[model samples]
Target chain A: MNSVLDIAFTSNIKRVWHPVFRQFGLLALVLPGASLFLIPWLWMLSTAGKDTALIWKTPPVWIPPVYHWDNFIKAWLQGDFAVYYLNTFYISGMNVIGILISSVLAAYAFARIRFPGRDILFIVVLSTMMLPRQVTLIPLYMIFSELGWINTFKPLIVPLFFGDAFSIFLLRQFFLTISRELDDAALIDGCRRLGVLFRILLPLTKPALAVVAIFNFTWAWNEFFTPLIYLDSPKLFPITLGLHRFIGRAQIDIQFLMAMTIVSTLIPIGIFFLTQRYFIQGIVITGIKG
Target chain B: MAARSSLADFVKRRFTQRTEDILTAYLCLLPWIIGFLAFTLGPLVFSLVLSFFQADLFTRNIFVGFGNYIDLVQDPLFLKSLRITAVYAFVSVPLGAATALAVALLLNQKVVGLGVWRTVYYLPSVISGVAVAVLWMQIFNPRMGLINNALKVVGIEGPSWIFDSTWALPSLIIMSLWAVGANMLLYLAGLQGIPTHLYEAAKIDGANVGRRFWHVTIPMLSPTIFFNVVISLIAAFQFFTQSFIMTNGGPNNSTLSMVLFLYRKAFQQTRFGYASAVAWVLFAIIICFTLLFIRSSSLWVYYAGEERDE
Candidate 1:
């Protein structure tokens, strides 16, 4: 038995250490995926730190001699990204709160309550998820125009107060997984339905709520279409729309643009890195069921 | 005391209980109901109505009753946009899904610093679409872009990727592949869900790694593959941000997508009714394609813990 165990272990090592296997083992797998995914960002970072001359040089410098940390400062200042950041944060923050409040209420009802036409109404809400926002763009614009809401943040933020189908759907799925006995107990404790939702379910569903918040934050921050359509003032533009002004028709400053691009992406990437565990779990469950 | 109460009193109490139940349900549903009516349902119905008319910026909609749809069918540019969208969807969806699956398969392997690699791969997924477009525009710059320089080192010259008509769509497709992290994460979940016993059984049967992957892994992962395909197809059809930012559908509308064209018509040209018609047509196309995919999925999508009909 000892010899057999020894042989098995040695053979495993030999198999792993085989020249062909070892040559292609980890490096081969990591390289192609990494290059495909990482090289562009590295290029963006490297170029953003280079001067114009170095940027335009033949054979291009993959790495700059000195990192121009000030380029980020310059990009931030000159691009008026300070204002963009403020506007973006304000809008995204409001939108997240709005989504959470309205979606939680709606999702709780869908998950816990029995009502006439409940299934049909839920299906109607879910069906809206299938309709691309583009399909409704023109009509929505017309409505906003009639209301004189264009060029204002109203168009961007107001609709968010109305529960989004995707958000509600996700939150409802989370709510459904929770036991009903908790709600019954809350009712016996003199808690109203709304009170139960706030005190009992919301606390238990922190991960789901976090997922919703993170999703909303990133999406709202990166949202370009609505901002571009509704916002006419450059001061009101988000980082996404503001960044486009740098890439004009005739010529583009490659380094400056890359620098600005890298800077703009940092916030969302940072948020994702911070909350990735919840985000991944959310995606897995949602995508599989959806 | 209950025996002494009149029948009318008990009936009145029951009526009140029913009304309370109804009121409670409506109260809970108020936000979604109002939103659905004002935002979603309202706009949808309005679009359906407006698609039958022609409206300028200031005038009342002139009823044309399918005129815009007819024009869409006849317009060469609309046809071109539709074809472009179809091609974009077909190419990008498959490419994105394949890359995602490949990366997920790699990440599923027992490796060091797995978390770091996962984060690295996911970084692009979180980056703003406009930022990615701008970044890639520079990277694909014909002269000094890293891609071109790399090609020059190999004694080959890279084409102007964004500017060249032939390369613009493909450039966007390549850019889409950069954000495969979301799908990769989905695939990872799918991979982990596959029972390990299957692989072990295959190994004991003297099946090579390739055979095990084909017979065991691929079949188990088909549902995820199907899901990715459908979602990616839907997204690719509405491809707008990259083209709008990078190319502005430029160089003779080479990169003009269905959504971008709709945007141009509605926002730029101020033909709201016409754009509505175009949008409806797009919706129909998407529905048809989605239904087709869903119908076809039964042939391939395998659900665990379900009996196969055949």
Candidate 2:
């Protein structure tokens, strides 16, 4: 929550005599670097709207002569992106609900309840985070195939309902920050444990919940590996898979590829901009307190 | 001591409370426990067992008992993939951390439109996926690509990145650095948390800027740096998506990451047992490095208010 100007150890007395000089110097260095960071995005925007002839033009054009915005329409139509978008939304929606419910309940218990073997259970949860998902891919694939869940959203969405390690850990940290007195007072007023959670705790942790939701949504939206393995049907492919398939099939059209890439990036970028404050706060809390 | 006794008292009063705290806790944890058993723990143990047998999707699983693992050691492709991943992980972890820390240091200084700058720098990392991979693949194109075109202006001919074996792995490493903003943000957060008084104190003690940075800023920031490094290391080891999308272990399998190799084995070739063995090897390598990091962190990572046992 610290303001940008509230930075520690930035101000040096030696440079205090010429504050204006220092500011300009910092600006001179930073502006170009910031622009450098933004080049790929600007390039993406430029490329997505360019004419096919200009795509191969040597000394690549910075600005397209005529902005062919229909490339977006063309890419969408050609790639079956509507279906991919719908499938991605469905999967992301299911996962967000699943993670929020399971993580909130588990996090609340870990944060507030004094129960036997709580420490060991929490350790197991933490250990799961470190264990690479690759190690479990084969068996999980087998299990899903055995249950006839392959090529369905079930393999993609069901496991998240049990909750994920990182989300549970993040929510638990946020929950621990709330005072125990709030829970105690609510309990004293005949608010049951679940009631206390719903009425008292949930409201205070909305920011954390939003953070978890945004993260899960983005992760599910951009997810490729699981979708690639589980869902073979093009109809079931999410944005990432759909885009990959599109790229593979239409290797000749650079403009369409760029347009499709933009389409795939749009939702997550929109979410990031809208929920930026909460996103930064979530990362800071996890980095410092984790 | 008081907290422990209070916890003990709370447990003693458990019977007086109509709702069993333990039962409620268990109820709350039921979903995660089930998930752990079914998805994570079960698959983990199953995969370990799977590594021992020779099983294709259609054939009966034969008990080979370390035969798959022995083959993994001798397999040139597995060894090549491991080495590629190791190099990528090792190089990227330090390179990424240093670049991020540098950017964070610059960004920490009071500048106009700080929020915009942060957003600009961070957008790439946030939007990472197939889109990113595709974008970079285009950017690294030797002919008429942004990079080579830019280099052409300077009269330097650029190599065909991601297409030449010599440059393919390096191309992936370079692409990896594009997402340094995640760690940069972490460093910025860590920097803001340091007490200004420490800087003033260091200045009063006649420490110059370089001395202050080395002695105070670094020590204070060590824990954050350590955390970033470990997470980055772990992530780099499992690096995929981009290579899968961009290179597909191409240009003579030069960019074949361990996970990509595992994926090819499992999905493409249907070598389930061999892939499972590769997975276990990757797991072992990751664990060893993580343990090494944790062990070495004691010597360098500084936590305020924590006393060294020595």
Candidate 3:
């Protein structure tokens, strides 16, 4: 991996300036452009620490004269982010568990089980990934409404229990790569198909499981459209909904809004930074296989 | 008679075992099957049926026989939203693909802190959804935003983004550039997969950097590029949250997207039938574009497994 990633014509660098100079030359090309990408985040952090008057400054105060430490607290209280945070955590947590159980089960079957029509069934599952969610949105909304699940967390969390097309695809691809000898070895010990999955395959696929957990959680955390449509009441709203609703008042309440935005994004960003490898690996596996 | 009876019993036992294996497989697939039937297939079939009826919150659903779709043809708002969505998809797909490839190429350069640069560039996708929309709203604020403030630094007046009808769509396009990180990562992986020996061979031919990129890098990465185009196109057509949260399809409805239009029709106006029809239209457009993209791939997309130009 380290070797193939080096594509630059580096022989020229040895003939030119010092080795350190070459590093600086590459950084000079990359750093300026990268800083621009980081600006919105940095700019938001700056505003979160400033007064409303300073936020509107033409030259823009890169650093606030007064570090508003209380802005986070103020935003936390005013936005009622405690309940929103709890709601988001509950929804995302249940969503991840649901996705894991269903996807792992289905992926194991698809990868290992050699039943009649298995290939056709697997293709059907894969094809669902391409179906536009919008096509089904109206009917799903109406169905939940009829079941009296609207304005509640049921609509948001229940669908995940059935599994997602992408997660199933991801896990299935990972499962296919594992040697089938492990499953056969387990089965010879008087284990059933389910036992083989639990005792051998599931334990072996931890990295893939981690990948699913990360993707499902991040997706649930950042989800907006579904919650936007279903969860009408503020009490049940996730942070995304809360932040969106608060934007109307963002003009008048600039300080707290910036602080709230910063707090809301912290978890997914943290997860991303922490688990960068599994996340990128998941993408590569999916991209190549799919 | 005894020999025939033994043969029949043996066949019966084998059939039962096979049935059991098949049953176990299905039991494993039960969640997906049930979910598909209840959640996916049911809704799709229901939506199709609903599109032919006069369904709403106020009145009982009345079968109207393609009335909603016919109404779609004449409805000016539908046409307007369709046009806006079409334009957004056309511009953003290519721009997003090009920028993503560029970022991939830049990051592909062998350097120290490569991981750090990759992470920083991907930062925007991490903090996305409504947070991203709200963040950009402030950044594009005409009088006080960072973009205009920077423009003011150079003594050129900045356009009123997201508020002006002319610039609202374009502003959304600019903001869309921020989330190209995931696609970039895929391209980065594609870059890695291309054996370095290809580059050594290119250099042996005395290919310059520009020629190497055009002849080697682009062709090698064409499969990834093709994937990006299709994925970006499907996503771009479903442009909702940015316009929905930031502009609400406002400033003379210049930024009114198809999904947002469908949402309003169903929820706000209680025109479920109309909304269902609009969604079918969106789905059809996506299918057409996807097919077109696949058809065009043979002309440009180069599979590494196939014969290469000698």
Candidate 4:
């Protein structure tokens, strides 16, 4: 590989003098790739900053005349984003706690405990990954309605308490990677199973826990379908559903809508950045090794 | 002393040991077992039963014995939804997978600011789906949209993307390709796993960059590609959000996906039985496709650890 690197370096140096070929090749790959992802976001930012008349102008101004920072405040007030933020935070927080507890306990069982039919049960759990949520939606809705849990946060929070297959799988993979010697030592020390989980496993698996937290938070935050179907009142609406209301109420106000969109999107990205060290480590460790 | 023990004592000890093991294991599994029974198995069986009956919002279900499936086979809307879903799946999965692989290959080059570039590409995938859809709706607006204005600058007229029946599904496909970051990350992992010695040997044999890529890089990355393809296909078949948010299956039902149609039938029209049937059919189709892919994977998926048969 080092030799290949040397040869590739020489070849690249020789090829660089051919400016036209180099530029074309580089531009062909990089330009389209970057523009495909970036241009729309740039357009969103620019449009959000523009005034109403300028937004509709021909040859659509790539830059706004003056940065309308008020669009953010206006969108915040008009969209009732403060309420949406609180609602989203509350639901997502509850969901995160629910998923973490359920997933960790389930993962510990699958990873550490031995019992008859364990493998069969694990397979049953994994098989649910293939079953699309659409298949379960109608019947689940009926069950919820019968229980009179509709139009409440119960439908949203209760499912997470039962455990999610993906989160369980991820945490199990992390657990399996840990050394069994530690568990044996804990056992010799007369630690009960639950004590081992809390005192030993939980402390060592912070990366996995962080991954679960971030994943649950993001999924709960961005979830649209269930929240859209379950929650009827605007006061209970998450940011995702709240943004939809903005479009529904003022479809023509592109500037205001884009501003609200940006505002709503910022928190998740911020969360990702803050927890990213553990997130990437979690993925590379659990996903690849498993 | 143990051998001299009475049969009652031995039997009692064995029974206690058995009970202790079972109790400990079951205690560990208690939460997941309860969850599986409640959320997964219960709903699964309920959906299966519901598919066979006719029900409305205000009344109990009437068992009709496959009547919903029969109605579905004869229904034009169901057929249209299936066709639309098939096209959406076939087009988007391959396109998204190919784009992700290509971007991954390009970024795999020893380039400066690679981390920054990776983050920029991944930003859209992390953005709220509603926010992305709403933003793209503005970008794809018929007259005053950014896309049209950009096209007009180059003397080309852009179509009314979401409003035009001809362009609506394609417009969603275009929007979906923006979030190729997840697959890109997967591919990057795959790329990193390729052994460096092979590339070294290829260089010693005077293989050029393109040749090395085709012969070495591609063969090594096939498994990751396969994984991405199957997963992406499954996801695309259930496509709902873009159509739900942007087109709402409008302009003559150009984008009435299977999932979207199911949602409308169940929620909007309150036809729970027929919607449940549609959901089952979609699930069956997804399973069939996945099985087919799994069957075919042995032909192309190169397992690094497997020994070749002589």
Candidate 5:
């Protein structure tokens, strides 16, 4: 009595019809849906590799007539991308280190230690996570200006050492899942507080740490608003601001711009792929725990 | 040997014990506390004062006693920017969430090449801001862009896109879909979290695919939906950079987002007090929506293994 489309779910018909009918049925549903997500990236890649004039050709060339390697070189040197990449990577590295140390320590305390006012403090941190960054943007800028930290990496890097609320929450959640018996055993084995944290808990929390690292790295690398607000010097520009400047002040060579876009995208894409499982797992855990 | 060791251990433990546990805990929490004070709470408190005072980087503040708020009401462009932003957020969040959830449901099935599809879907979201915006700008270019070229193939004329006042916001909304992968992934996580036993029970009760989705999946996924809704709404309100970069708040200020307007006001024109008032107004609006959503969530958001009072 089931229609062909509903046959996949009907128990009696599914076993008989699944081979071609159901599989192809799924393909019909999945391919078009998948293409909506996939085509834009493909177009970007294609456009990046194509000739500048050929891009606007009326018939729309899906395949490039010839690959232009010079676009990448021009965008790299002419666009001042070397300075941007260096500044962004350097900021990202400092951020990773700062977030790791602070978030791990804070998470460990919240998860394991007994202290008065701990619950209230944790609540405060969680609430801060929901607040949009704009709420704090103005005052933070003024404070940095007062401290003579504007136009320097101080505004960018100094805050990382103070722990991000989300990172702390994430690490704390991960730490709670760890067996406490390991802590007691480490304690009885002539280990002290820092020792347990460094050797046992930290190593066990690698996935969580990687998630924190990935988030900080991407955030610092791509952060434009903060850099725009705080840094006045062109030399202090992160890649995001540098690229924005490129779009505004420089050439409109679509070919070169696409190449530059690809280059800028590579680091995050590389990071995502390298930590693929961890990214998925980390996000999943966070979503479920929420 | 055991007796001797036990006595020595007892003495060591007693010596190591201190009533400084509170101090030790605080040491761990020191960085966050400092950060909270300096970056978050400090800025928040200052924003209120800055809103009432005509303050910027150069000039010392002159308190204007709600003059900024008064100007905000009279300012035509401010109201226009708010309307534009509200429209953008209201339209995009629900549409984006629905598309993301739909794609997630499709991807959740036992489809072949799942990894390829997932990576492809998530690829654009990870690509960062300027790059994606630049790419989309190219895609939305007036005549020679990919979208127009495709439209040509279908014998339909494409609008000037970001350049055209009528189509600019829609163009941005369409571009916003390119990164629905982030939302899709969250929904996927929510979907996978649903227990298989529930599905089995539904199947035994003769529930069809549509019925299972409506009855079992929806209620279970309500919490995730609520969370995404609130988060996306906040993000939508804070939208900038794209409008700032792509159209410079546009041909007729059609795409002049509130944040873009705030950025221009505060940084470009150096009207810090007015900008601070704008930011607080934005914050207030966001708080209103968030509270509204949170209150309404209780009517439908279902947490498993828990019962709520009517």
Candidate 6:
């Protein structure tokens, strides 16, 4: 009966949809869309390598007549992007470290420990995810300003130490997936709570931790508005803010601006390529669960 | 021996293992608790209170209860920003989701070099922030941009995109579609999760390709679609950095989003009270929209094995 049914139904469907045509059709449809997405990046490269004069020429150059390696150097020096790069890295590093420590502990507690108000507190954490950042932007600014944190990296770096909502939530979900048996067994074998988290749970939850770290780093590195609001001094600006400032200047060459823009984009793109698995896994986990 | 036994007895009597567990949990949660109070709850309450007063960041604090809210309703620019934001969110969210779904469906099929294709599409979404704004600024440049240059090749003249008031918002909406790869990834994950047996069953039941897709794929994928829609809608409402960088609410406030308007009010203009009011209104709108979607979700969203409340 199964063979007959398979032959009748599957074979009929197979005949109706040829594999070659289906494959060809998919490629034909997808390749155009993919190329369209590539245009901006390719155009940035093309324009960045062109002569400053040629960048704005009509029927714009898709390829530079000659590659301008000096454009990157000129743009980098022009914007003091070295300082921006260091500042961004510092911020991202601090955020990743703080997020890991705080989120891991909080997530472990929420996942494993039964405390009074645990559920209520977890609900509060979840609701904060829904609370738009704009709603708290002004008051946070005011609070930070009162503390003399404005124009310093403290405002950017310190709040993250308290544990971000998304990171904690993601880590918590991951911890719940891990068996409590491993934790209990560790405890029975004379492990402390932190020890179980650090030794047993942390080793197991490495993927989740990587996801949290990668995302926090990318977000901190790409962060523009926070730096825009907090950092007034050009010397303290991250790459995003620096790039914004670079473009705001009049008499700036288009090629040079594109060069700086490309420079600002490189690290995040490189990070994405290197850690695409964790990045996509993070998105999938959050998307499905949330 | 007597001292050790007494000490152990005292410790055990003072703290049960359950009590110790609770204490440990709270200790672990202390950082988040302090943060929640300082960053989340405190600011939330403070923002609400500030909305009632008229204050610059400094010393102009004067109580004008409901005055900021009233003024916001009457203010034309505030209303305009709301409309612009709604229109942008409504257009961009669905458009992005649909495009993402389509791409995901295409990619779900038997294809070679899937990784390369996926990476190529997903790469653009990763290079976000001010970089995206700058890249698209050049891409939409009327004279020197790729779009216009390509249009010129086809003998069609393109409008001054980000510069023209009429086209600026639409230009942004178009620019937004380029980064749908993130949503596409979500959809791909969802697609993979849908059991293949359902499709085969539909085919066996004499359902054609189109029918099989509609009956099998759509229902199965509805949950994911719903998720993407809610997330994208919320994100769209808060859209700022791009417009802030690319247009600065320009070509006559055509691209002025609620967040951008609030930014101008608070940061640029230092009307902290007024911006707080705007923020509250924006918050209310976001809540209403999210609730509306969730409330209406039962009508369309299908979770396999879960019984609907019909």
The CAPRI category of model 3 is: medium
lDDT of 6 at B105: 89
Q: What TM-score, computed on C-alpha atoms, does each candidate reach?
A: 0.93, 0.94, 0.93, 0.91, 0.93, 0.94
Clashes of each: 0, 0, 0, 0, 0, 0
lDDT of each: 0.85, 0.89, 0.88, 0.84, 0.86, 0.90
- Candidate 1 wrongly placed segments (more than 4 Å): A1-24, A249-252, B1-22, B204-207, B306-310
Tens digits of per-residue lDDT, candidate 6, A1-290, equal: 68898789988888877787788888998899899988888888888899967887886757777999899999898889999999999999999999988888899899898889988898999889889999999999998899999999999999899999999999988988888899989887868777888999999989999999999999898888889999999999999999989988987888899999888888989999899899999999888776
Docking class of 6: medium
Q: What TM-score does structure 2 among the candidates reach?
A: 0.94
Per-residue lDDT of A226-249 in model 3, one digit per residue for the tens? 999998889998999989878766
- Best candidate according to DockQ: 6
Docking class of 5: medium
Q: Candidate 1 vs candidate 3: which has greater TM-score? A: 3
Clashing pairs in 3: none
Point out where model 4 deviates above 4 Å. A1-28, A250-252, A283-290, B1-22, B205-207, B306-310
Positional deviation of residue A104's Cα in model 3 after best superposition, in angstroms: 0.7
CAPRI accuracy category, model 4: medium
Candidate 5, residue B135: the lDDT equals 86
In candidate 4, what are the lDDT values of residues B1-310, reduced to their tens digit? 6665767776886666556656776776677789788887888788888899897768887999999999999999889989999998999888988888888887776555577677777778887778889988888998888778889989998999999999999999988888888788788778888999999999999999999999899888887888778778888999888899999997789999999899988999999888989989999999999999989988888778864221
Q: How far is candidate 5 from the true structure (C-alpha RMSD, Å)?
A: 4.1
Q: What interface Cα RMSD is found for model 2?
A: 2.3
- Each model's TM-score for chain A is 0.91, 0.92, 0.92, 0.88, 0.91, 0.93
Per-residue accuracy of model 5 over A136-176 as CA lDDT, tens digit each = 88778778888999899998899989998889989988988
Per-residue lDDT, model 6, residue A160, is: 91
